[model samples]
Target: MPPRTIGEEFTKGLWHENPIFRQLLGMCPTLAVTNAVINGIAMGLATTFVLIFSSIVVSSIKKLIPNQVRIASYIVVIATFVTMADRFLAAFFPLISKDLGPYVPLIVVNCIILGRQEAFSSKNSVGRSFIDALGMSAGFILALLILSSIREILGAGTFLGHQFLGSWFEPWVIMILPPGAFITLGILIALTFVIEHKIKQRR
Candidate 1:
């Protein structure tokens, strides 16, 4: 198999293997905390920190870990970074921390993070794993931003807590609820499929 270029490694995560839109990996956080843009951004960054660090650690120590215990080791490495991210958010951004609640700690089990470690990092170079992690993180963040922006705008008539829609706009209270997340995510995923199909046909 040919080695992937750095660009290929990074860009694939943006769309082709996007954790949310494409692979549909991290739905819990994607749906739970994305009613507001700030929460989405905070969750994205925190997840990014854990994913990147865990990938690097897994890549670095892959050879030392026995096959029988590799999965457990990966979880431990991932958990260490998750703890750091959780503590940092709580200490520096109390409100966002409170908003995120258990989701931040839940990063330890996020398939996007663990799947990458198992599928790519364990067998790849540290640098390659880092790039893959970075790409995946960017994709995750972008997904959250798109979902949160639409939700916030229609649900609360605001973007990132700043009102963009005027008095004429009536907020759709349902857009900020659990049903809203499902509805918005479903639409976005459907649109993504249509766009990808069009692009493939054009080729």
Candidate 2:
């Protein structure tokens, strides 16, 4: 395989290898906190911060980690970052922190972060790992943004708490519920595949 350029590594996460849409990693926060746009943005940012920092640390220390204990090491690194993120949210953005509940801290075990560490960061140069993590984070954020926007708009007839629809619009309560999230995500995933297929056909 040809070595991937840094730009390719970064851009791939935005669409081709998106953590949520493409890889289907990090579903917990994607579903749980996406009921609102702000929550999704907060969760996405926190996950991104943790992923980027952990990737940099893991790549830098890859040689020192024993093969047998790498998984444990990765968790420790991830958890440390998660704790910082959780505390920071609590301290500054208490409203968003409260809204997110346990989901924010649950990022410690998020598959996307660990998956990248195991599959990419541990084996790649620090620069490449950083780019990969950034790409994955961007992809994750984009997915969350899309999901949250749909949920907030359809479920509440608002965007970011502002009424976007006219008074005649009735909010679809199911859209903000768990089933609604599932349905919306399913449709989005299907749409993504359709777009991909069309692009291939054009080529």
Candidate 3:
């Protein structure tokens, strides 16, 4: 295999290999906290912090870890950043922290973060790992934003808590529910597949 350019590394996660839309990783937080835009953003940022730092640490120390314990070691590294992110949110952004609840701490087990550490970061250079993590983070955040925005707007007729629709518009109460998450995610995933197919056909 040839070396990947930085642009290729970064852009892949945005679309080609997006964590949610394409890869379908991290569905727990993706579905749970995305009823509101703010919650989605908070989750996205927390996951980003954990993923980036964990990737860098794992990439930097991959050689020292034994294969048998690499998964455990990666968890510890991911948990450390997860703790910091959780603490920071709890200390300052208490409201959002409360809203996110356990999902923030559960970042320790997020497949996207752990998968990158094991698959990409462990074998790649620090710079490449960072880029991969960043791209993946961007993808995750983008997914959350899209899901939350659709949910929030359709469910509450608002964006980021501000009303977008007037009195005539009735919010779909179901959009904020669990079924809504599934429905919205399903549609988005289908759209992504169609878009990718079109792009492929064009080529």
Candidate 4:
């Protein structure tokens, strides 16, 4: 069926139901990875791969799974993908993998992927579910990029590893620290709400 094609399933994960900005899923990795551009991108792609495949598998077998066992099933599926991603990164880029630490494994617990399995993927054909997963992944990546870019520039006086700040620019040491991540994300959330409120008023 046209509605159940792979393209439709994949694109939604890129934008419409974006797991980060729209669905508010997977906040942990989004916040943690944006410290550096490389980290943010790597985390995003890794999550996207996990989400897309999990959706495919879950949707494919939705009819076979019992209602009571769905949550456990979804988590096991997610954990498998996370392990693959973690191992892949460790083998190719040991430094980044070390920096990411246990967070890669923690993707198994990412609320976004599980939420999609329950709220969208389980009820849809495999094709549509895949798109939703992809859209969510894109959205998550976008959010991470925005947050990480802001933090990196203001905190380190650099963007993507390049120095943009003059000597007069005082880098906020806190930006790279864990506390800074919390504060920055908090402010961004507030700003997002303010903009949303303004947009609603216009509509």
Each prediction's number of clashing residue pairs: 0, 0, 0, 13
Full-model lDDT, candidate 2: 0.94
lDDT of 2 by residue, 11-91 (tens): 999988888887888888898899999999999999999999999999999999999999999999999999999999999
Judge candidate 3 at residue 112 and give its lDDT.
97
lDDT tens digits by residue: candidate 1, 1-203: 79889999999999999999999998999999999999999999999999999999999999999999999999999999999999998899999999999999999989999999999999999999999999999999999999999999999999999998999999999999999999999999999999999999999
Say which prediction, candidate 2 or candidate 3, comes out ahead on lDDT: 3
Residue pairs clashing in model 1 are none
> What TM-score would each prediction reach against the true structure?
0.98, 0.98, 0.98, 0.88
For model 4, the superposed segments whose C-alpha errors exceed 4 Å read 1-18
lDDT of 4 by residue, 1-203 (tens): 45545665566655444566556777787777778777877787888899899999999999999999999999999999999999999999898898788888988988988998899889998877876877777777777888888888888998888997888999998898788788888787677778767888999
Winner on lDDT between 2 and 4 is 2
Candidate 2 minimal-lDDT segment of 10 residues: 20-29
Model 1 regions more than 4 Å off: none
- Candidate 1: TM-score? 0.98
- Deviation (Å) of 69 in candidate 3: 0.4
